[model samples]
Target: MKGWLPFAGGMLAVVLGAVWTLQGLGVLDSGSVMDGVTLWAIVGPIVAVAGVVLIVLAMRARGRR
Candidate 1:
């Protein structure tokens, strides 16, 4: 229960980041301002990576206990 927060947050971030990346790349149009935005294209992958890192850290911490 204690470790679920980061894991859940990370999962959400990852999913959102993927969507943002696709939208920014003009691959997944959603009729939003973020669509085809260059900044989101760049930022998306970074956010996704951060989320992955968070997930990994959370898993590692849980494993050590």
Candidate 2:
């Protein structure tokens, strides 16, 4: 397999995490309760990092095969 699932999922996570981070930081406006909550500002980066790690693992798996 080419690890397409992980690659795509990671990309999605990166996008969502960035949005959440922006919203939590009040850098972006949104109606959701999570907006400007401050908690997501910290959590968002962690999620983004996890996504990047997932992407890296996916690439490594692809390269191996």
Candidate 3:
């Protein structure tokens, strides 16, 4: 379970990144993904950070057990 956390987070990051990219490219228009600079600037960093955090946690969990 713990080991899977990183995989889950990475998968989430991939999915979100793809969605935003597609939206930006006008291939998928679910919403205005680039309407503001905040979303454009923050989404990638947030996803990356979350994924790294999850990966670190998963690695630490493995070390404990």
The candidate that wins on TM-score is 1
Count the clashes in each prediction: 0, 0, 0
lDDT of 3 by residue, 6-58 (tens): 76776687567656655555566565747333454456556666666776777
Off by over 4 Å in 1: none
**TM-score per candidate, chains pooled:** 0.93, 0.91, 0.50
**Per-residue lDDT tens digits of candidate 1, residues 11-37?**
988998999899999999999999999
Local lDDT at 9 for model 1 = 83
Candidate 1 similarity to native, TM-score: 0.93
Which candidate number maximizes lDDT?
1
- Output the lDDT of residue 43, model 3: 69
Worst 10 residues of 3 by lDDT: 33-42
Go through the candidates in order and give each one's C-alpha lDDT: 0.89, 0.89, 0.64
- Per-candidate Cα RMSD to the true structure, in Å, reads 0.8, 1.0, 3.9
Worst 10 residues of 1 by lDDT: 1-10
